[model samples]
Target: MSFRAPHDGELLKSEYALRGFLPKADPLTAFPCGSPYAPLDEIGRDLPSLLYDKGFRSYARGLRLPPWQTRVSVETLPLLRLYYVRIGFLASAYVNQVGEEPVETLPGNIAAPLIDVAQRLRRPPILSYDGYALYNWKRFRKDGPIALGNIDTIQNFVHMYDERWFILVHVEIESIAAEILAAIANVKRKLAQDANADLNRELWRIEGAVRRQVETLKRIPEHMDPKLYYKTFRPYIRFFDGVAYEGADTAPMQFRGETGAQSSIMPMLVAFMKIAHRRSILTDHLDDMRAYMPAEHRTLIKEVAALPDIGAPAYREVFNAILDAMASFRRVHYGWAEDYINRRTDDPRGTGGTPYMRWLQQLLTETEARRL
Candidate 1:
């Protein structure tokens, strides 16, 4: 609930904390039909009901969707993301929604804008964590805190509280990441100045931030029933396997779903905490998740990761605590994935389109192994 971005301006990635990786502006609720891309926002608003209607695909085809001019710029980046995320939801729902067959080709009206907006952002034209959590929420009050209690998801695949709670929980956790990022930034500054004594304290702060994230992550079951999550809403966010954009590209274009792996927070922590995982399929997939993150967030991980090791014998214990905290976080994630996804289906693949059961266990095991 508290905004923990560094008090000092020099401390963290500005994009990570500024108005919460969530857009500072309230996203437009509707675009006029005059806009070439009105369906993204307009039909997107009514998507839940339309999804259930057997005629949904035909209805989408009925709309007149124009190709994007691609006149996007960094200044209106949030707007483009707004358009991108909405269209992404539409495409996912059209393909994965219950009544429809899992269609292999994404419609051009949807594909065109999705690809155009995504090209501008330099990320895959799919619903990623940036679209799913970071750009998917709005606050109840104009001046309220950007926390779970005050915010709600802007677009949803279904009209369920479980869906709302599921997304907002990530929003709250992303807010908590500010504290962790501040700690990482201070550690970087201390490392640069050869201040080993002060580094331990900052490392402890990082451990504390990881603990806070675990607490929020643990609250997933309180409002969101795992059954509803798995059966109803989860399908819309799964990997785009063998699916091609109707007009954008004819080849089968695949991208990971809007999973937590795409979140910049944990990757930044992984790089900053120095918890080295042995190379494996899971590590490669983790590395691949970076491509789904915002470009600056990707750069931030690189910047933190490029720092030389702490190298001080005294800081090893604190660093070990940080590793243990990270392992604990992964353990909680692994447990829920088992309870929620693994038990429900035969498919070993998670939303990230990886063998998640093995992958998560591997992650937890690797982090524990790095302990001093």
Candidate 2:
């Protein structure tokens, strides 16, 4: 089903429900004027940065405060370390393919082999929503962290693949993929458990809980808008950057810095195409493998091979179109950059007066150009 924006009343109702109290009568309304349910400054630090507390005198002052540090468990730490390694390897592969200088910290040349190993070690596991289970349940949750404070509106999941299909891949890949996810999840879960135990045992639980409540109070009352959520959350979305590339004689090598939507959209487009090709090859091989089988099994194998090439063609076409669009978009945006600088004394956002907004405008221009 297509997404529909919530009405203001719906947003307000959701916020009220999530907070576990009526809006006006809630203890959060008391603030500094009365004995607050929790301390204001302490709570401000615990709340998500996107939210603002109505009671807080200065958002800047709140921002300047030190953030709470949660203890990381050894089990969880290793998983995080592995995640970093995976990211490094992926980055390296991209860079190597692009024929560029590899960054020292990232695993520049080992990405493909590492990912292959990961794929081999995979297993299919049931998706769980347990907070203590780890692996970022927030990613799978219907309402994400954005809904924590405001409660009125929830952000939709914005993963590149369809969740159901992606889950199916895990099932198809089975054991290896499942094991990888469980390993990661287990680590995160243990870490959170350890942290929580430490907080409780050390008599810090009261302080932490109070601080969290206070911060919750301070956050902006507005429901999260999807566009705003995307803009704010874009940076945190993982993209492997700064891997070295080995030169290739045949393939075109293009290197460009990407941020915002392009950073994610580009890599996803590339990965989707690569996966499509792999699936096609696998399907073909499965067909060949069937030829050696008994007549009954052979028929079954052919049937499997004949299953529609679901995403391969569509993803390939979409990616190519995006690339074509990007080329024209880059040219026009660069043109605007030149024009804007010529008219202005100082470059705002240090982008020569044409930031992402100009680039996006150019993308629209390219789309129109394509229509012509």
Candidate 3:
């Protein structure tokens, strides 16, 4: 099958270079105070304390929150991202904070801004991976590496350090994804020209990056206690099922939670590596997750997916190594699910609202079978 090449791969390369995948969703950013939007900022700054107080739901329901009805300007995108995070966190807390059962409706004040920002951002209105992880961190020191201990979360539902660690672990993973994204950027030109040697070189680079990503991902349990993670902060970001928005014209929305599924790293890699997962309920959920990622990232995955297959013998080995790294990530993830979520409850649905144990097995088998 022939794929038409973009000019000089500029569109492809520049898309991956945009850094939307990083914490540059802005640590230095905040909405201006006492403006119409100040309520969200104040609520965000007060989230941890407010969550502990039994009055959190009352306080959330009582807010004179902004409608944010104006068309979002391109210049305000960074601050807009911060707006989504703060308001999204508050909304999650409102739903899951101290309820007999998680709330089924978002009040008008809470729903309006979320519906607005999420539509403008081309993602679901709930707190998906972007709000919960990618944009959730800020480096403690300006010059510090974006690694564990150096990074901390900007927002949380609880006061535990495990919450911070859980979010930061994903932040660190996103940071390592830069190298893999760079390798992907280079491959567009190689594929366009049929430069098999260069393509093979990039396949190796991607394999190394995946291995490094796995190494960093393995550090999740270092400071995050599984019980703390499962019990305290996890529920705030759990999936939305038939949840209605009070004032918006929108009907009840069913979106996945703040999940690892929404991360673009693996989806982009699966697309780039030419690994096609079998069609199943799990694969459909995986495809649906792209709707919650940044639109440019979704586009990039499609671009990478369109690149021709690398099926040579040597290319196959590098592909297998990358799959090995992916499998290792999956194994660690399995241990996490077992320790953090599965053992703790009888419910089969994970935070992402999938029967993940069965899904993961399918994933492992598919990855092994798709080598070259």
Candidate that would win on TM-score: 3
RMSD (Å) per prediction: 4.4, 22.3, 2.5
Query: Which lDDT tens digits does candidate 2 get at residues 1-372?
Result: 111121122212333223211111211211233322123324322333312233322332222222112234543333322232233222323232222233323221333333332332231010111000111212234344323322211111222222222222212221112222222223223333442211112112222322333333223223333233333322222223332323312222222221222111222222212222223432343223222222322332233233222223323443344345434434544444344332443433221112444444444444335321
lDDT of 2 at 171: 22
**Model 3: residues with Cα > 4 Å off, grouped in runs:** 1-20, 23-25, 33-35, 69-71, 193-197
Off by over 4 Å in 2: 1-55, 58-263, 268-354, 363-372
For model 1 the TM-score comes to 0.90
Note the Cα lDDT for every prediction shown. Answer: 0.77, 0.27, 0.77
> Candidate 1 — what's its lDDT?
0.77
Q: Show the lowest summed lDDT stretch of 10 residues, model 2.
A: 123-132
**lDDT, candidate 1, 256-324, per-residue tens:** 998998887777777765677889888899899989998877777777677656635667788788888
Clashes of 3: 0
* TM-scores vs. true structure, each candidate: 0.90, 0.21, 0.92
Q: Sorted by TM-score, highest first, which candidate order results?
A: 3, 1, 2
- Candidate 1 Cα errors over 4 Å, as ranges: 1-39, 66-70, 194-197
What lDDT is obtained when candidate 2 is compared to the true structure?
A: 0.27
lDDT, candidate 3, 1-372, per-residue tens: 333444553324543454427744345445665556666766787888887887777778888877665556666676777788988888888877844478789888888888888988888889989888887788778677777878888778887888887888888888878778777777776656764435667778878877877888888888889877877888888888888989977778887888898899888878866777899998998888889898877877777777666655756678788888888887878778788888889998877888888888788778778775
Question: For candidate 1, what's the RMSD?
Answer: 4.4
Clashes of each: 0, 21, 0
